[model samples]
Target: MADEITVTVVDDHPAMLVGIEQWYAAAPEPLRVAASGATSKTAWLPPGDAADVVVFDLQLAGQTTPAFGELRRLVDAGRNVIVYTMRDDEQTALTCLDLGAVTFLTKTEGADHLVSATLAAARDRPYTPPALAGALSANTSSDRPKLSIREEEVLVEWFQSESRDLVAQRLNLSPKTVTTYLDRVRLKYANAGRPARSKAALVARAIQDGLISVDDL
Candidate 1:
């Protein structure tokens, strides 16, 4: 609340954190780097404090699941949160959006985009990339694939080799729906030019892309 925007950066890499701090230091506005953390214990900031923006990385060393809970806490307390990470899967992106992230910036994105996203989030606006926004909006876009939540569940079960009947019973979905979901998955892979010929191949692709870990399935 000191007129200048205050930001906290959370990442497991020290060099990345320092680089981000340096970027803010050179910004035109008086940007304050409040706290930097490589772990959750060090990242926890008091609610309703001087923080105006929080740049969070989904993955941390020694932690399995992304720290969505902590990020959600910050958003619930009225702090703007930006999920900056190497992860760019649709499911993970959707999860971050659902958990109230103001922006999602992949590490592969340019530095200019990162700075722009930070500035936009500071102003309390959604700062998603145009491509990502379009992908999420155009559910029927031929270039993009869409997966229902149930389809994702089915994919996970298929990855685990769960029987169709067992998967339907477990997910409370009809067996017919499960088959439909599998067909959709095949169609998606075919569109991408890497059709999975078998259920094992599908699971391998999913795990390799960080869509769903083996333990998750």
Candidate 2:
């Protein structure tokens, strides 16, 4: 991480907005609050400039998009999101990660820790507080599925290729066969208590399984 890092903060509470701004203001040379907004609808992007990481609150005021949907919106906009909220349970943390959060932090942790976590996330490393770490660790275990050689080939190609048909063409197999292998992969994940129901989720699983690195995405 750089000695100076830029961040954009999204929170719904007025006090929280002030508190976070003050927190970042007091942080050491490592953290800088580049921009901040009090609502999820607040624009994160500033023309010709972008933040290194986005620290966000999951619960926004009013009836708005789902937590993960808002998270996806930030990521899809090309900002790495660090979920900092009161909803620090394992399920919420993992789900945010599933939707592509760079890391998760609880609101109760010290402001210094939040600054550190934000810095770590800016460097593409996840900083899991000990409490949330347990849940993430529990999701991957020895029972994690072992794919057959062909299945591995299909999955690897699927990860590398842009589409299923392209994967099929490259592997010289019918699209149907490719689908079958990918389906089995999903089943195996489900059997292991790891449910990857979407293509994005499967890509996350591939990263967890060492099948691909973050950069490959």
Candidate 3:
């Protein structure tokens, strides 16, 4: 978290673009807005493409609906995406999470949450704001990946612990074993049609499946 986390912001509103840059600049943490744009098309190029994380607005300029396509594209390209939009509905939040967003945040959550989420996303760590936690708790979808008892234990410990090596030490297992268990968990999620490649995504899946809670993180 000590390192300056680079960010790319994509929002249709000119005021929002400027506001986010100001917020990042004024934040106590090292969050630099490397690039910004009114659309995802331009944001996915150059500086934006190389940013540590991307803060995306779900509703863009010319879209009548939430920009799921843009979000999916970024996630598929292995970019860490945080959906910073005005849409606060549980379904929208869950949909973005399922699409592999690092986390979903509403603009009204303020700069603190934005800064925190950006930092966490840059490290592929989990940071659940109030809105995202509410969405996870309200989620009623029963689509959960089946996990072995060991895999489940490792996943929860990994979420609570700082690193996999710490989890291995706590469980008296090797680091490689811890990683194997985590990989299995991820495989199960992918087989269930839900991909959990990043730690934040895994945390969201764990919460939705009742394996862990926001309070645990």
Candidate 4:
């Protein structure tokens, strides 16, 4: 379908591939696993199933080709990517970001986070899982910032609202004000070195931080 966000997963472990397929089996509309394989060469995106994003694992069967090298090529080919791997080191995460990965999510972050990361990537956004987000700031000893009460109210309302204007109206704020607050949230994340960089990414962060649930989307 035109609206379906196609995905290609590259992981050597058979069970992980199965697990992701099962998780997305119930994902909301507009997301589908188009194809998968154990290595980049074997991974294929069929003519009808051109992938929008690739969920790649760092370690593959051969291990000769660095996953980052594959990532750069896929991204250069105009495909978004969410790095799904067991390694969660800040250095590797930073390298992935530098290599143009849309997001870097450790497998331990849970299936929901992986799904959310793909959604964010498809939307041209960056999603940093909570732990990874914090890792970005570890070098500077920076603590994650708290959103103001108004910011929290706006975010929750926006997530639950049918429209931004509706959220603004319900919050007794102007549409511009709502936008400003959301921008602030984005800026805060960026300033902390955990840049969310897009609306959908912020939504993912909201879910990660317990500010909202998947149902809220």
**For model 1, what is the alpha-carbon lDDT of residue 92?**
67
Better of 2 and 3 by lDDT: 3
* TM-score for each candidate, following the candidate numbering: 0.58, 0.59, 0.69, 0.63
What clash count does candidate 1 reach?
A: 0
Candidate 2: give its CA RMSD in angstroms.
13.8
> What TM-score does candidate 3 get on C-alpha atoms?
0.69
Q: lDDT of each structure? A: 0.62, 0.63, 0.74, 0.66
After TM-score superposition, the amount by which residue 36's alpha carbon in candidate 1 deviates from its true location, in angstroms, is: 0.7
Scored by Cα lDDT, where does model 2 land? Answer: 0.63
Off by over 4 Å in 1: 41-43, 46-49, 134-217
So what's the TM-score on candidate 1?
Answer: 0.58
In model 4, how large is the Cα lDDT of residue 38?
82
lDDT of 1 by residue, 88-184 (tens): 6766665565556666677766666667678766764334453334235433535555566765667667545435688788888887667656544
Best by TM-score: 3
Q: What is the full ranking by TM-score, best candidate first?
A: 3, 4, 2, 1
Output the lDDT of residue 59, model 1.
91
Candidate 4 residue pairs in clash (backbone atoms < 3 Å) = none
Error of 1 at 217 (Å): 38
The sequence of per-residue lDDT tens digits that candidate 4 reaches over residues 1-217 is 6778878888889999899988887777567777888877544447323777788998787676457887777766656677888886777776666566677788777877788778767866445455455344443333545667786676566545525689778888898677666545543543344232333454565566555567733
Which has the greatest lDDT? 3
